[model samples]
Target: MRYNIIHRTTYKYESPVTVGHYMARLEPRTLPFQECPWHELTIFPSPIERAERSDYFGNTNVYFEIEGSHQKLEVIARSLVEVIRAQPFDPASTPPWETIRDSCRSDVYNPATPAGELTFASTLIPVGVPYADYARPSFLPGRPILQGVCDLNRRIHRDFVFDPKATDAATPVEKVLKQRRGVCQDFAQVMIACLRSLGLPARYVSGYLETVPPPGVVKLVGADASHAWVSVYCGEVCGWMDADPTNDVLPSERHITVAWGRDFADVSPLRGVTTGAGEQRLKVAVDVLPDKD
Candidate 1:
């Protein structure tokens, strides 16, 4: 499946004063099952300086700086991507959850393991007893890791309430678990916490989820929004399989991956420090349209 995605972010500030620098992680990645051959970023009040670089996790990150006074800021990104389902994986055939867990905790001398780096707590998610407790029900003794993770995914989908107003980016996982409410980001983080607390390797995924309208119905422009999901390392055979606890589905052609990391802080689409604009209002509009060609 192929798609054309447009993401627009607009910021209107209360007052204008000076300089601003921003970083964006809006480019989709090309992996064995996904390909991102073309993408672009457009910024209003064109920046005085800009550069692109790959971060520690290998995600494409672009930075730009605006030198004078500006009361408003606007950034837009466009991407064309193709997603293909990978080889079939058998959850029951995967190694027991404990095996992969141990591999992830191996020695520092071991060849750098991406899964290992994600097994512990990070900037936003912290390993804790509560997280383990929440995950224990699905992880039975010697259970195949993927099988157990599927159960955990469904449980999260069934348990939480999606409320955008309930929490912000800064909201902690502990609070979301307590309130049982949050957006996709909250669910993804909570799931990561649960996996890590159980000594398993899991990462947060940020991207776009295609929203289909009813048959013959017109699709609304800018109706889609950025999405977050979870990816668990189910041993070496399964590698990373994407799961969307928020929507209770495994990511497939409808899900387009951008960047991933230990938590949202690592892959936020846009973030930066500005010398001006004391207070600001942010509006984000996203459209993920199927490309006819």
Candidate 2:
């Protein structure tokens, strides 16, 4: 499947900002099952400096600075990408969950290591007794890693509620766990914490999801928004597998990968520091359309 994606972020500040530096990770990833041929970014008030680089997890990063005073800021990112569904892995064929978890603790850690770096706790995702207990029910002894994780994913979707107003980005994971409600980011982070508490390697993924309206209903422009999911490393051959607990499905063709890292703080699409600003309102609009012809 091919897609033309548009993402726009607008900031309306009551007080003008004199200087600002911002970074964005809005480019679609080029992976074995996906290809991004074109990408463009437009920022208003034109930055005084701009640079592009890659992060530790290989996500494209763009940095720009605005020197002059500005009350409003607008950024537009456009991309063209192609994605194909990879063949599904047989869950029963995968090694047991315990086996995969143990390999991540090997004494020698390197690029070739089995996801040792991701097995530990991060700033946003904390591994605790509660997390392990919350996930243990799904991971029975000798169960296939993928199958076990899928059960955990289903349980999250079944138990929690998708309430946009329930939490914000800065809301604690414990709060989300207790409230049992939040957006995709909350679910993904909660899952990551659970997996890490179980000594497994899991990462946070940020991207876009194709939202199909009801039959015969026209899709609203800008109705789509950014989405998040969790990726678990299931041993060597079965590498990173993505699961969306919010949707209770393994992400595939309909999910467009943007960036990934230990947690949402690491791969946030747009974040930075600004000087001389008070009271700001943020607005984001996203559109993921299937390419025709």
> lDDT: which candidate is best?
2
- What would the TM-score be for candidate 1 when compared with the true structure? 0.96
- Cα lDDT for residue 103, model 2? 78
* Residue pairs with clashing backbones, model 1: none
Minimum summed lDDT over a 10-residue window in model 2 is located at 105-114
Residues 1-293, model 1: lDDT tens digits: 99999999999989894888899999999999899989999999899999999998889999999888898999999999999987657779988998888787777544326678788899999999999999999999999988898898899999999999999999999999999999999999999999999888899999999999999999999899999999998865667888899998888889999999989999999998988788899999999999999
Positional deviation of residue 155's Cα in model 2 after best superposition, in angstroms: 0.3
Task: Count steric clashes of candidate 1.
Answer: 0
- Single out the weakest 10-residue window by summed lDDT for candidate 1: 106-115
* Candidate 2 lDDT over residue span 75-105, tens digit each: 9999999999798798888889998877777
